[model samples]
Target: MIRVVVVDDQAVVRAGFRTILESEPDIQVVGEAADGADAVSVARRCRPDVVLMDVRMPRVDGITATARLAGPAVVDPLTVLVVTTFDLDQYVFAALRSGASGFMLKDVEPEELVTAVRVVAAGEGLVAPGAMRRLIVEFARVGWPRATGPLPDLTARERETWLLVTRGLSNVEIAAELMVSPSTVKTHVGNLLAKLGCRDRVQAVVLAYERGVVRPGLP
Candidate 1:
């Protein structure tokens, strides 16, 4: 079963998510919290596989909570799926930088929510392609300056695979593009993740943008 903890300030929202998630046989709501501070404590106790977090909760806020639970400093990080009513780029960027594995609007369909949780739990990132593009554009617009120096040592093939990943290409698509087998693509992706110190493709995508390795609307 995929254990999950739901955190939101609104009681109704928490109840709704619990109901939707509990309906899935493969998923279980292990705990719930009404604010960010409580979320941290509940998650620590439950050690859930996934956390459905709200961005604007009082006390600590989802971004900080995510950083605490899943940041690079964490030895054993929990997968966080940030669900918020707002589609603002700031929230999305903050959540990603804080080590969230996925971000979704609160209005997302119940089915999509379930899939997102499963995806993140399986060690993948689940941001929509459109949202990712917007995130890159927003970063560019703001001139989000990140330290640009020698990139982590990556082979030429691994660098190509990383660029395709940032472009939102699936493994099969990357394989097709590079004329290689899917297993080969997967190997390259794994190597990229390890070398970049990214938790998943989502983090790698964000890192690519932050490092100016990839830009919005570019080939």
Candidate 2:
């Protein structure tokens, strides 16, 4: 079973998520927290496979809580799916930067929420709803402030791979786009991650935008 912890300031929201997740045989809600402080405590104690976290909370915000539990700074991190009401561009970028495994809106359908938990539990990351537009807007606005040549370090193939990733293409899609195999794309992605010092594709996407290596609103 995929152990999960539900963290939100609203009692109803927590209860609602718990109900939706507990209905699934593959998922179990191990604990619940009304604030970030308790969320951290529950995470450490339950060691859940997926944490449904809220962005705004008392004591500590979701960004800080996510950083503490799943941030790149953590030696071993938990998978945090930031469930927020806001689709604010800043929140989307900040959550990814803080190392959240996924982001979703609070109003996401129950089915999507379940899939998101499984995706993160399987060690894959998913960007939140409307993430692409937000990503592009944020990057386009911020990336050129310190513009330079196509990331000087990336190889031709690596740059291609990075472009596909930043465009929100899946590994399979990238393989098809470049007429390569999925494993080949995966290798390129891995190398790009190492070369770029990125923890995951989310960061790669962010960097690709922030560096103008990829443009916003481009497919």
Candidate 3:
């Protein structure tokens, strides 16, 4: 089963997510937390496959919680799915940068939520929700001020794969785009992720923007 820990300040929200996720035979809600502080402790104890984290919890925000749970320094990190009520919440980007596997708006349909947990659990962060797509368009237009370039030593093909990943394309889509097999795209993605120091696809997407490998008004 795909064990999940639901973390939110609102009791109803936690209950609602638990209900929705547990409805799936492949998913089980193992625990719940009312805030980020409790979330860390509960997650540590439960060691869930997926953490459904709220963005604006008291005591500690989702960004910090995600960093603690899944940052580069973490050993055996857990996958985190940061959820926000607002689509354009800037903190959601921060959570992504902090190593969340992915994110989605809280108001998403129950079916989408279930699929998100399954996708992240399967180690593919991007699903049909398109949260990463919104992040890319928004960041591409606004442009981060910390203009810095210098991607790690990436081969020509690896760089191309990295760019497609930044666009939030899945391995299958990337394979079709590059006219290669899905396995080849997976290899490129794995190699590029190792070079870029990203734990998952979404972090790689964030790194693309932060490194200035991709930017506003530029492809």
Candidate 4:
């Protein structure tokens, strides 16, 4: 079963998510929290596979909660999916930077919500291509600091794979572009992630932009 912890300030929202998620035989809501501070406690106690987090909770916000639970500093991080009513690019970027595996609008369809949970649980990112592009553009507009120091040593093929990922290409699309098997593209992607020390593709893409491997306003 996919264990999930629902965290939101609104009682109604939490109940609604539980109802929708429990309707799936494969998913179980192990706990719920009314705010970010309580969310950390509940999640640690329950050790859920996925956390459905709200962005604007009182006390600690979802972005800070995500960093505590899933950030690079954590020894064994949990996967967090930021679900918020707002679609602001800043929130999306902040969530991803905080080590969230996915971000979804609160109005997401039931089917898509279920799939997103499954996807994040399987250790994959859930940001769509368009959202990712907007995130990058927003990061650039705000003049985010570029990555400092030497870049990780990646092979030519791995670098190519990373660029393709920043371009929002899936493994299948990358395979076709590189004229290689999909499995090969997957391998390259894995190597890229490992070398960059990224938790998921969203982080990888963010790192790529920060390191200037993929610049903004490019074709």
Candidate 5:
């Protein structure tokens, strides 16, 4: 079973998520938290596979909580799915930077929520095509000034792998596109992460955008 922890300030929201998650035999709500602090405490104790977090809470907030629990600073970070009522671009960017595995609007369909949790729990994220577009456009507006110049350290294969990543393709899709094995794609991805100093694919995408390697609206 995929253990899950639901964290929302509202009791109703937590209960609702619990109900939906329990409907799936593969999912079990290991615990629930009404605030970020509780979420962190419960998550560490329960060691759940996935955490459904609310962006705005009375104390700590999901952004800080997520950072504390799943950020690169964590020795062993847990996957965090940020579910927020507000779709503010800042929240999305902050969550992604803080190591959130996925983002979803609170009004997302119950079924989609379940699937998102499952996907993140499986170590795969739900970076939907629409979400990817939003992320690209938002970051494009900000213009990551520090990511200029070619990544001189990247190998030819690593550069190609980065293109696929910035295109929002998964490892499997990248492997197919490059006519290479998934393991090979994974290796390239790892190398790119190390060379670019990115914590994860989300950061890699951000870096690609800032460096002008992948412009917004590119097919």
Candidate 6:
């Protein structure tokens, strides 16, 4: 079972997520929090696989909470999925920089929410491709994680995998595109992420954008 903690200020929202998530046999909503401070406390105690967070709470908010749970300074970072009613880029950028594993709009369908949690749990994230690319590019300009300077050496196949990832292809799609197995693509993805000093695929995409290896709206 994939353990999850849902954090939101509204009781109804929390309850609704729990209902939707628990309906899936693979998912189990283990806990809930009403605000960021409590979210930190509860998550620390539960140590769930995924923390579904909400921004703009009364105390601390999701950005700060995400940092507390998964920031670079953290010894053992937890996976965080920042789900917000607001679709503003600022919140998305802040959350991602602070170590969120994935992001989603609260208005997304229940099935999408479930899939988001599963995707993050299975180790791929950043919601849909188009919006994720836009957010990473905008954040790249701000240069929070600093994807500048010389990129480490990468194998030709790894480089190919990286570009396809920047284009928002999943491992399965990349496998088919390259005529390679999915596990091979997974290894390539992992090797490339380590080489790029990226914490995740989202940051790797940002690095490519910052380095001008890829540009906006090019197919």
User: CA lDDT of 121 in candidate 2?
Assistant: 89
RMSD of 3: 2.2
**Candidate number with greatest lDDT:** 1
lDDT of each: 0.88, 0.82, 0.83, 0.86, 0.83, 0.84
Best by TM-score: 1
- Report the CA-based lDDT of candidate 2 relative to the real structure: 0.82
User: lDDT of model 6 at residue 64?
Assistant: 95
lDDT for each residue of candidate 2 in 110-218, tens digit (9 for 90 to 100): 9989988988888766765366666567656765333355554888999899887776677898999999999999899889989887767777776776676666656
Local lDDT at 36 for model 4: 84
Q: Higher-lDDT candidate among 1 and 5?
A: 1
lDDT of 4 by residue, 1-219 (tens): 999999999999999999999999999999999888999999999999999999998899999999999988899899999987755678767878888988778887888789889988988877766666766677678765577668789999998888888877878999999999999998898888898888788788888777777777775
| Model 6 poorest ten-residue lDDT run | 138-147
Query: What TM-score does prediction 1 earn?
Result: 0.91
What tens-digit string does per-residue lDDT give for candidate 5 at 101-141?
Answer: 87777777889888889878877655554567776676568
Candidate 1 lDDT trough over 10 residues, lowest sum = 142-151
Candidate 5: the clashing residue pairs are none
Q: Would you estimate the TM-scores of all the predictions?
A: 0.91, 0.84, 0.89, 0.90, 0.80, 0.86
What is the Cα root-mean-square deviation between model 2 and the actual structure?
A: 2.9
**Model 1 regions lying over 4 Å from their true place:** none
* Residue 6 displacement in candidate 1 (angstroms): 0.7
Score candidate 3 by TM-score against the native. Answer: 0.89
Between prediction 1 and prediction 5, which has the larger TM-score?
Answer: 1
Q: If both were scored by TM-score, which would come out higher, candidate 4 or candidate 6?
A: 4
Q: After superposing candidate 3, which stretches have Cα over 4 Å from the reference?
A: 127-129, 140-142, 145-150, 217-219
